[model samples]
Target: MENFNPDFLEEENDDLYEHFTFTVGKGQSPLRIDKYVMGKIENATRNKIQTAAKNGGILVNDVPVKSNYKVRPLDIIRVLFTHPPHENLLVGEDIPLDVVYEDDEVLVVNKPAGMVVHPGHGNYSGTLINAIIYRFDNLPNNSSDRPGLVHRIDKDTSGLLVIAKTEHAMSHLSMQFAEKTSEREYVALVWGNVETDEGTVEGNIGRHPKNRLQNTVFLDDEADKGKPAVTHYKVLERFGYVTLVSCKLETGRTHQIRVHMKHIGHTLFNDERYGGDAILKGTTFTKYKQFVENCFKVLPRQALHAKTLGFKHPKTGEFMRFNSEIPEDMQQCIEKWRNYSKYQELEE
Candidate 1:
């Protein structure tokens, strides 16, 4: 961990600034107060908003409110940003960090499975951001509390991720990711043997109407209303009944790999949102069917791991790469599949 100057503002002077007003919308009802204010206020961080609400800067129908206060339809929410300039926005906690590489300008961390990248609903602390705040006094201001985070990995996905330490580094890295110049590769354990060695999945991803938490692929007509997503996959290993694959992203969307894999009839193992469970059940191999069911019960999340990351160093303008091995649980699942395959061969 390295110490850096804190960038959060500490105090506000009424003589120096003016107040702005924003109204809450119906779509924002039931959302956390901190999140609601963050959405309405430009350049305001969640931490700042939370602090303001705690100090009575937030008013709902002319009443001071709390950060966790849930909004109701047509609620009139007002925020008065009158806080002093503070340099330290987040407190550093001694949360564990799997450091792959570290430099003055950036850090590459091997994020463990089941760790959320940043704070959100039901998770305000113990996140990668919190750990980074502890390690580095502060991150660049491009993203408020998030500091140097340029991209994100799913909470259940283990892999390599990079963070920028300075504003210049954050901007440079973000541009690379936006331009698709950064190479991100993921290793996944899919439910069935891929019929081909390589393939591409291109489609639009949008929220599921029936299931709000899930994303679905749509066509050109439907895609107009959806976000573009693209994934390129190559088979890495074949186990007769299951396949190990590596996928690269051309475009990143929510659950792009899981959704695209499912669209092609080869969902990642243990993926609850997609069709992985259903596909496993349809396998003709009785041994694989039983293995998948048993493994599914024990595995906590989908078998997707980000194994490699490649991009130019934000500060140096030189190419750099990072890699992380699969987590133990996923590796064990692969080993079990191999052993089961061997046992079935003996029976044959």
Candidate 2:
């Protein structure tokens, strides 16, 4: 399978994060899975591979396999570990944070727009992790340098995130996310008026084969191409040219909301990656075009935000929930659309 979106590689509140995968070649001879994987993956040790296998992270054709399991020709192998790859050493930066709640086991932060969750590819420093490490000491984490991260949102998409401060918290929170007991809600402005009050979108989401940077729903016959993902959305409000919707994720796939909304012909507004930046639904008037351009200027990135998050407390059995106000740019853009929608009605 192609690479999954970084944001969806691991679900929210997951401890066993998937970072690498390998496929046995057609001519490959039968060999122990751990040994076979060790030869293919760099910086991996026997101990780590065995431990992952023991934890049910090693999968052959989507089924968990042990380290001693023999890898046959054409076997698809996936290795998911709790820790991220050891790339650049983590260095704490004194960046400010919008902390909402804190306890002995967890910390809730309202991440702003333009902050990547972890270091990857071209983004190494100046991430949320950097800020987190600078403020806190010894966060429990195994994956790439993102310590204590239970879930993540795209850098451009702002929202609430929960961090595990201790091993017990991390394990407990991971189970909750993995079991799909956690609740996450997003507010978004999408082009076109949504016809329904609420609906669900179910599809397999994976990386676009032609464009690796973007993701799409797999409606084709290629069954093994993507992973199953579900997103439930409710129309919160409707503007003449665009609509504001609340999206709840059932399975947190990479770019799940963006891709699912697009699949249903209602792409998120100003999402440059999935082609929402273009005017998908609007009038042909020059005034309308200019108005949209101004809106884009106000919110240069995707018009999506993680508005609410809820899960059971790791230490206490009581449930906890948090909500965040929409960022200034998105809020201002929505207001512009709202006024325009009412103005259009008055004109008619």
Candidate 3:
């Protein structure tokens, strides 16, 4: 079992960062602390673990331990890092939001595409946090700059998100997301016709070594390079070369869905960061190329949307679900693909 303190977790990107705790099994034998911990934590290197131990970030039975400390059976071990990697000063603005449902404890909003979820470097203005603060005051804040945000979707992904209004609500909602009990479903259009109706992608996702801005799956030799990530997906519709799919996240690593889908050779359509902007599938005909270009113009960003979100109300313990209509640009692009797919069928 894992234990995380609510006060230590910071809402950043999608997954909230917090301390990690592990209880040693009764059958476990004595071993070097660094070696034992490396085996328990995924993607953790011996060097990094040792460094953390030196920094007093590793603890055994509530006391700081050194790299060479011997671990005994049934010992409680913890790796705590209270500080977030990055935090920007929050500045509230009067940007409008499409509030879906608001109660004393929670608020659900349909976030539009092209809106940043929180304040961060180079994104200090016109963010959802700015809008949220402008509209509602006295909202609970996490260790990071984001206030009331329990989880987040990418800036270009339109969808439903839940905000906590009180401290209890924040802690409760954060626990749900951390436990992976809250439901989140995304709709995406990928470049190829995915052969499987449904499937799961399992891999360790880490930042690309050459491009820090991109994320990639590290497997085999680099298996210990990043955190474990899993994404479950089902085909919703097939539009010739491009297929529409719905994805459920089992783990919310940064860019988990986008990176996992790409790992399987079906990069989300128009996802420029992952090399999906160009035509990765279909014929190379001039007219086909032109059609794709026009479709790209219609939908300027990654063809993914957070369509459905489900979770139990923190205060009421009642199940709540919300769905958002696909944005107009993506809708128009999907219609264009539908027509194009039919035209190709007729030619065949």
Candidate 4:
């Protein structure tokens, strides 16, 4: 939670790379700010915290402070740091894009599954950024310096994405996301029949203590361990072994939907990264097992789609919403489940 959020658009897309605020306990003893930070946050290095202080990334009661600053009781501490540079070497590539809507300030594209939003790490090319930069010019760069992207969706998730063509548009679009005024709806096929027709999942999401590759839910006493995240789900359809659900995001923590869905005991169908790929549900009948496996082959990735996206027009202040068709894989998988459910009910 790689760069962006909205489950988090991966973490690279999170609004800020790092922003932490903590209150010193009443009984807390005096300690160096850097050292205190290292203790409170996992994987934080002394050198890093010191560097952050040097960069004025550390604050005490709204004032920038040095690493040597002594923490006292009731002190308000804030830490801010951007993630390491990414999309730095992005170059325009002549990749085709499914552009849905475009204007002087904004562009909406229906991004297909398997396409990275921007370049980073192993994926240095063939991203939506590469494609858009090829077609468009002088697109605005956000605080992270990635041009045109205001938000992002996962590589395996198919759906609509809005692009900012001007700096004014960028700021406006980003503000909407941060303020939760924008609307995003995702459809997912998850294991288990969710008991409630609609429900809200309120939990703090943070990186797993042991599994750095995944996010976990922390609640109640441990809520502060992670970032606050909220997901609202409504049952769309039900299969004997799985359920199709529509999820709305209130906060875009990294892997928010994936982690929250898993936490509620209904991991997304075929979400391998979150342990939804295996046969988490279904029966022991050899025929049924084979049927499920065939469905998996039909839809090899997580059964999630960014079906609807709505946001205010950055320049005109007009609210706009875009809808996209489910990808072939997910649609086929859902149909298979529909038939399977129909036959299973007849047998019962």
Candidate 5:
């Protein structure tokens, strides 16, 4: 709500690309997405922009738009390319990976916090993809030319991910995700106490027009502007000021859990971009503020983790399920909150 860290947000890359973002000027005339982009960047032809749009790299307000989509005033547009601004290719780095499961067809990895899933413009190295390329050989490239990648988690969120090693494996895994047959579950610490033990939040999610870095739920007639997303959550613990919840996602839209929880008045704890850094539900006391600050220092990023992943084996047709533990930072933060809630101390 105040300031956003763009560098952190850009760390989550669905594809390895250099993304250029634009905010339409108030005085600018309305134009198609392709023509508008061509005018803004030199050496960018309309056809080239159209091609990028066809590839779903043209985003308006975080929603993929076609080349003919009209760009309105104040729309946030992001144009992405497979290469960097300087056209440098991706390089592999020898980053250590926490391989939970691996075989000839697939590999399941527990990705740590602060690690990017793939390379981007400003982030071209030290990504999980880079590590995969370095550690393995002959990984079939996806449509984006990213090898061994089927899906990705956020940069700050610790999680389990399944990587495909062969073309047949990639196709099988991607189809499972596309048909919503895969199962993904997350553990999130959110602000406030969730009244219900379990519930579902279904909404269309898109970019916030004013805040380009954040996404919001689009409802009513505006729901068509965004894509359908569904998240079902249940309370795990009540920490007074914060609640720990387990979320199962039916749809995997970008920032689905974060925005959906916030829509229901339970933003993920310590989610800086979503206003969870502030004390949203705690007492107005110096001690409470200091306690929360200590928790924030313990876990600097959003309190969300992809705890479980289940899917059919790409090659063998056997169902496989994987789960990861909560990272140290999040575990320590939860302990601190648990102690605070047990004592019920609010005075300075």
Candidate 6:
């Protein structure tokens, strides 16, 4: 690797790019090369980063390294981002979106379940970001092409989302989310009956110690501690074993609803990561248990959904609210509960 100024790496580009170099920071050792690069680069997808590493785009101390190579202290890392293939990159598909409202400054859409917000990891195309890119000609040229994304819901979580069309709108909307002035609500069918009607779970959430793919609550104070998160939930209906609850997020954290509910002993139905299996076992209805197990075979992700979003419009200064009905899979879960009640009556 030549003596390239790191400052040149920050230059804006509308075309292909070359290799960029960065140094491994202290206490940042023992991370996979791809994972390390993902943390270092803003808005770069993991798959793209990994692809670059595999093709000799990433080098350590002037020697090419694999994606899985672990980093040591003071390692010189270089990443070359080759322009992605035209088909693999995010492009506007002519997919019809349920646009709830649209204006010059902002747009609101009822984001469907199973649509990822942005390209990442295994998902590189057919995302909401791609759709927005297709719909609008001039997108904000920020770190990512997703200019107006104020916040995001999980891929399998369906709900209302606001997109800012202008840079000013994006800035104000992002500020609202940071200040916790925006209202976000979700409806989830959690395993196990919530003993309390309404309660708040306050904790710090960070990456899980053992599981690299999941987040966990950290109770103790640490140097690089997790951010403070609070969630208030109220049980809407109880099915003797499982319960339908409405969750209000005061602080947005990754997997906030799913993890916080689990931390309080009621994990979401069919959530594979936390304590979902225990709920399947505790239900009195054996048939229902078998049904849930079978459903898990088909439903690979968690059964949590974002149902409502409320925020003040950045440009118009008007309060905006949007709501979406639960998706079919979640509705099926509720139907199973109803059938469980019928089965119990027949048994009696």
Candidate number of the best TM-score: 5
Every model's TM-score = 0.73, 0.78, 0.75, 0.77, 0.78, 0.76
For residues 73-125, write the lDDT of model 5, one tens digit per residue. 88999988655553236667899999999999999999999998988645778
Deviating ranges (above 4 Å) for candidate 6 = 1-89, 141-145, 273-279, 283-286, 294-301, 342-348
Error of 6 at 136 (Å): 1.0
Off by over 4 Å in 5: 1-88, 345-348
Q: Whole-model lDDT, candidate 3?
A: 0.84
Evaluated at residue 190, the lDDT of candidate 1 is: 90
Tens-place lDDT per residue, model 2, 126-174, is 8989888888898888454458888899989998999999989988988
The clash count of every prediction, one per candidate, is: 12, 5, 0, 18, 0, 0
Give the candidate order by descending TM-score: 5, 2, 4, 6, 3, 1
| Overall lDDT per candidate, in order of appearance | 0.76, 0.86, 0.84, 0.85, 0.85, 0.76
Ranked by TM-score, the better of candidates 3 and 4 is 4
* Residue 158 in candidate 3, Cα distance off native in Å: 0.8
Q: Which structure is stronger by lDDT: 4 or 6?
A: 4
Q: Assess candidate 4 and give its lDDT.
A: 0.85
> What's the lDDT for residue 300 in model 3?
94
**What 10-residue stretch in candidate 4 is worst by lDDT?**
1-10
Off by over 4 Å in 3: 1-88
> Where is model 2 poorest over a 10-residue stretch in terms of lDDT?
4-13
Q: In model 5, what are the clashing residue pairs, if there are any? A: none
Query: How would you encode candidate 6's per-residue C-alpha lDDT over 172-285 as one tens digit per residue?
Result: 888888899999889988877788999999899876756656678878554344678999999888876678899999998988998898888888877766757444545466
